[model samples]
Target: MLQKTIHKSVACSGIGLHSGKKVRLVLRPAGENTGILFALQNGSGRRFLTPRPESVIATGLATTLGQGGDSLATVEHLMAAVRGLGIDNILVDVEGGEIPIMDGSAASFVYLLRMAGERTLSARRKVYRVTKPVEFKREGKLIRAEPCDGFHVDYTIEFPHPLIGRQSLAMQVTPQSFTAMLAKARTFGFLREVEYLRKNGLALGGSLDNAVVLDDYGVVNTEGLRFSDEFVRHKILDFVGDMAVLDAPLWGSFTVFASGHALNNAFLRHLWVNADEYLEEVSLGLEPVAGLEAEPGMVTASAAVLA
Candidate 1:
């Protein structure tokens, strides 16, 4: 399996979830081994940032990656879109401190990536494969990961609400499955919570248009739910994004229960700190699977899975 990057540049503008200001995002093709590079525009100039477990400085309403005094908020959805589509190298240019909410799902980012197209590179892909089982638990939340041939997730989310009770989903994450199943699931929050966030000067751009807002009894969105299990699917989408903080893609079967952004980042930190006991970096060979020719839109699970 070879590394991949975008074929051309693509740009979009939208309102930031926390900043409530117009933000511009540009995606440009990068050379092999570039990974995901962020060129953050600021008053001084552009500063490059590479996502890492420790770089996550905050996880209130969204994952915030920070270095020095610079930080970018609401990055998970876009990260999920990049990793889910099997893009190995790319340059993300951000003009605002936060990524656009974009309907609070990865769907828009997926569309942008597809429009940018995909190009295979000469370098073979590399991944950090789990070599031993590891479990991280905090309070009642938990994340357990075990060795697997590909990236897989069994996630369960429990909420004390009539509309959300408990939802669970398990799947082998691939471009086909991620695009068809997880990409459209929108982030959700409660009515009271939204009010509190706004009062405290947060989630300023959040609304029914970007997120699935639930009142005391049911959904407030006129469109209703995108899927019966959209909540759980969204959690899985977030899990993919959180794991992308690693320098290389991770390959493992993860079982997550009631884990949020804070717990997810904690678990990732644990795994990274104890990497000698849990991870093995392996290079996926250059050749495509026998009898399978690499082509655009090909669903080849034989290639190592993306986060």
Candidate 2:
């Protein structure tokens, strides 16, 4: 599959989840092999960063990438959007330290990307294929991955709350499936946690408008759930975003259970350290697999969303 980038530029502004301050995000098309670049706008200068497992410094309120003295928070949703849409090269400019938590989901980013349109590039796509089955476990949380030609995830999440018991979802993550199934599933938190965060001066911008707030009985949001299993769907969305810390798309089938950002990044770090034994880099030739919709030398935005 060929590389891809956005056709044009698009911008959006909203409230930061943690800062409760206004932030601006600009999405610009980039050259082949540029990968995903974050241009942190400060003063009249910019600090560029490429997301990597080692760069993730915080995963408490959100995934925060830190390098030198620069940092960006709440990046997982936008990263998930980029991964879901399959754009290989793009420039992300952030005026504030955190990405805008639009509805606490990836739908807004998805819409922005689709509006920007997708442009195919000349270079062939490079991906890391899991060559051997690897399992990373902590307590009861587990993440198991095996070699696959495409990105797939079978995720299960369990909460003690009545509103969210055990829920599972399995899918081959294509752009269509991402947009239709995962993009709209908002992040969720308990009422007590929200109250505590507010009292501690954290998650200042978080509200029912962005996230699904659950109480002891059920959802506190009047609108209710987006999906019957929205909690698990959101977990799947987060998993996609967390995996994007890898420079290239990871081709594998993953089975995840009760795993969050911390465990997710830990697994990636483990994979990176043991790459020679468990992973192999593969570049697709200029030939389309039979029955695929795109051309021989091209990968559609929807088909190559993850890898």
- lDDT tens digits by residue: candidate 1, 1-307: 7789999999999999998999999999999999988999989999999999999999998999999889999889999899898899999999999899989999999999999999999987878888889989889998999987678899999999988899999998888788999999999999999999999998999988999999999999999999999999999999999999976688899999999899999999988998889988777754444443344655443444343
lDDT of 2 by residue, 1-307 (tens): 6888999999999999999999999999999988888999998599998899999999997899999989999999999999888888899999999999999999999999999999988987877879899999999999999977778899999999887899999988878888999999999999999999999999999998999999999999999999999999999999999999877788788999999999999999999989889988777765554433442334533223233
Each model's TM-score, in the order given? 0.94, 0.94
Clashing pairs in 2: none
lDDT of each: 0.90, 0.89
Cα RMSD, each candidate:
3.1, 3.2
Query: What is the Cα-based TM-score of model 2?
Result: 0.94
Error of 1 at 233 (Å): 0.6
After best superposition, candidate 2 residue 23: deviation in angstroms?
A: 0.2
